[model samples]
Target: MAFGLVRIALECDKEEENKGVRVLLEELVWRTYCNGKKSGFATRRECEPKE
Candidate 1:
């Protein structure tokens, strides 16, 4: 995720920083929660963001 974010930051235009961060966080949320649950890989609630 870190590497992917870094690549996004570097490859994306400066004007699109907000969009990049939004997309990255959205994807992380899906992977951390939805996908995890679907695969039966529990995402610890304590480690998740309150929001």
Candidate 2:
């Protein structure tokens, strides 16, 4: 069996949005871990209109 985990970090600006409430996930960074070891890293990015 294999085990995996992912940790995400979000960025928020504005006190009103941080009142112990949910906020929009505009940007974030994530790290993946497998078998108790770091595996990969990823970040949120905007895609171009023309793919």
Candidate 3:
């Protein structure tokens, strides 16, 4: 039998000056639930040019 897998990708903006430090920043992400249970949180940010 084959199992199904789910993948998610998030894009964020690259700061002009700082690149490494931006990853540490925390943004409030909305929570998602499935079957009356918490599933995950979703957050969005600016996307980089390469991304």
Candidate 4:
């Protein structure tokens, strides 16, 4: 039963990966994080250097 649940979770993750859902999720996380920050400086994520 636990293995079945893990398989389902992985399948759902694969589908979302192909649909670029991670980018959307990251955008939401970045926005929420920036909004919660106390600094007034720049907070845009696109300007961040790719590591």
Candidate 5:
């Protein structure tokens, strides 16, 4: 992900990767991210849920 995007995502307390998926769903809408992707390095699976 781009540095700017990462910054924005982190500021929103969003998890970078799969976990970010949930945050996007809660904070942003479908258009917030890719058509079917999340934010962060490693695949979406890299970042797991807190609990």
Candidate 6:
């Protein structure tokens, strides 16, 4: 679940800095459960964020 959320946030905007990744990860988790089922693994392709 953490991986899925992080992947989506990373895909939203590329963040190389450690802090950026941290912030995005945190936000991902919050927005997800906060909104109820906002985050999830719908498909295999959805799990991978383009580089």
Candidate 4 lDDT tens digits, 1-51: 333321111111233455654543343222222333443232335555764
Compared with the true structure, model 3 gives a TM-score of: 0.32
Candidate 5 to truth, TM: 0.17
Per-residue lDDT for 1-51 in model 3, tens only? 866765444334455774445553464455565545666777757889999
Candidate 2 — what's its lDDT? 0.57
Top model by lDDT, which number?
2
Residue 30's C-alpha lDDT in candidate 3? 50
Worst lDDT 10-window in candidate 6? 26-35
For model 2, how does the per-residue alpha-carbon lDDT over 1-51 read when each residue is reduced to its tens digit? 866665544333444644665445543665656555667776768888996
Candidate 3 residue 27 C-alpha distance from true site, Å: 9.3
Q: Looking at candidate 6, what is the lDDT of residue 8? A: 32
Q: Who is ahead in lDDT, 1 or 5?
A: 5
TM-scores for all predictions: 0.13, 0.35, 0.32, 0.14, 0.17, 0.15
RMSD of each: 12.4, 6.3, 11.5, 14.3, 12.4, 12.3
What is the C-alpha local distance difference test score of each model? 0.30, 0.57, 0.56, 0.32, 0.39, 0.37
How does model 4 score by TM-score?
0.14
Using TM-score as the measure, name the better of candidate 1 and candidate 4: 4
Better of 2 and 4 by lDDT: 2
> Model 4, residue 46: displacement in angstroms?
9.7
Question: What are the per-residue Cα lDDT tens digits for candidate 6 across 1-51?
Answer: 344432232133345776444544433322222234356432222355664
Query: What order do you get sorting by TM-score, best first?
Result: 2, 3, 5, 6, 4, 1
Superposed Cα deviation of residue 49, candidate 5 (Å): 31
